[model samples]
Target: MIVAILGAGPAGMSCANACLSFGLKPVVIERGDHLGGAQRSNFHPNLWMLGFPGETGEQMTTRLAAHYRELPVTTHYRAEVTRVAASGDGFLLTLAGAEGVRTLSVQAIVLATGTRPRATPALERFAAECPRAIIGPLSDSIRDDIRDTDVLILGGGDNALDHALFLAERGNRAVVCTRARFSARKPFIATCRARGDIELREHCARPELGHGNERVTAAWANEQRAFDWLLVMYGYLPNTDVLAAFDPAIRPALSAGGYLHVDAWQRSGVPGIYAAGDITDTPQPSVPTAMAQGLTAARAAERDLVKS
Candidate 1:
């Protein structure tokens, strides 16, 4: 049986691996040329693969890419999925990309499109004008050029704190503006709090960014803070727009956060459709967890295909 996997990231690659192991054909499609989505840019070292240490995220992703290449999986790179429509027995995917528009039919499709950094409404107006100042998760496109700069970060979650710590360690002064208490774990919070270089501006409100000299300037509380860069560490959101054309029943399978709601077997409420990775409403969002979910989805697909 053919299993169509949207995304060739860690989760999608793991799903393809599992499918091959179960004697099934897997097709992996990625919007980007690289297999790793955010993992490739991750600065952290060592992933959850037994006792192997000192391995960077990029290294681990490269290893996974090598493993995937050795498999019999058919991969389509630079393919942008336009929409998904329900077919007679399964689904039809419409893609418009480097290869032009094409439609593919499959019995089951795994939604592992993953998640991207969410933009905050407060600085929405300034983002388009000062694109270089805004830093999003999975995107390190402008980091190297802005080293040792003062950045004002907005948010109080795990992502916010992580960026704050990273910037501080990289010789940049980062001020985190958050009206609410930190949503990150105690360990991360403590590590960030312990840093003297990183300043946490609790109870900050209406933090905004202004564009001048082709860069971002800080504007908050009737005063403009002197900062060379602005880094907003808000959280992420799933890329579920491709499913907008899906049946009405499919919409309810997604959670409020736009993540697909799946069961233990990674089966969405909609039949012949499964979701894994950061796109799913999993309690924890990490590479190891995403890989496990991918494996589960593949096994579930095998079982359901046999039953049918």
Candidate 2:
């Protein structure tokens, strides 16, 4: 059986490896030239990857990439799956890549496209207009470029609080605003609260934007303040828009929040289609969880195919 894994992240890689263990051919299709997915941008140490303590995401990727290269799976980098359609108990994927367009048929499909930072039209406009406006989780470039500055962050999630703490540690003052009470981990919330350089505001909406003396001016809560940078870390949204390219009649189910819907076995609503990693509606998403789910999905697909 041939399985199509859409991504080169931990989940997709794990899934491909598991498929090989079951004597199945696996093809990994990646949108970028690199393998780590979003992990490449994460500069912080990943505490969740057991036995690899203190290893940053980049280091982890190095290990993963090295191991993955030793596998027999077919890999396609800088590729996009332009279309997917149902075949005889399988699916055909149309891929566009550096080598031009091609098609592949697989018995099962695993979606590990992952998630991206949530954004609004206004935020997009601000990011395009202001060089200092940053979005999404902290990256290596952001860390190196910003220091000892005033930052206004929007969100109440773990990411927002973590960014605040990190910036404060670097002597930057952070003002974090959210539309509701924080949903971040208690430890992050507590530490941020104890910090003198971090200001946490609840029930705060998005601010009106302006510019003053090369700084971004944020007006909200009946006050106006200018900051060196605006960080819009409004959490993540699953990258499921690719489903729209599929034939609507064969599309898998998605949650109201736009995440893929999967069962305990990692099976999707449509037959021969499965999902794992941040693309699925997992309650607590993490690196370990993604890898585990990937293995589960691959195993389930193998079992189902064998039985059929």
| lDDT tens per residue, model 1, 187-227 | 97888888888888777884555667655666676777767
| Alpha carbon lDDT of each predicted model | 0.80, 0.89
* TM-score result, candidate 2: 0.95
Indicate which candidate wins on TM-score: 2
Clashes of 2: 0
Best of the candidates, lDDT:
2
Q: How many clashes in candidate 1?
A: 1
Model 2: residues with Cα > 4 Å off, grouped in runs: none
Question: How many residue pairs clash per model?
Answer: 1, 0
Q: Whole-model lDDT for model 1 versus the true structure?
A: 0.80
Report the C-alpha lDDT of model 2 over 55-138, residue by residue, as the tens digit: 988888888878989999899998899999998889999999897999999999999999989889889888888877878976
- List ranges where model 1 is wrong by over 4 Å: 46-50, 121-124, 249-252
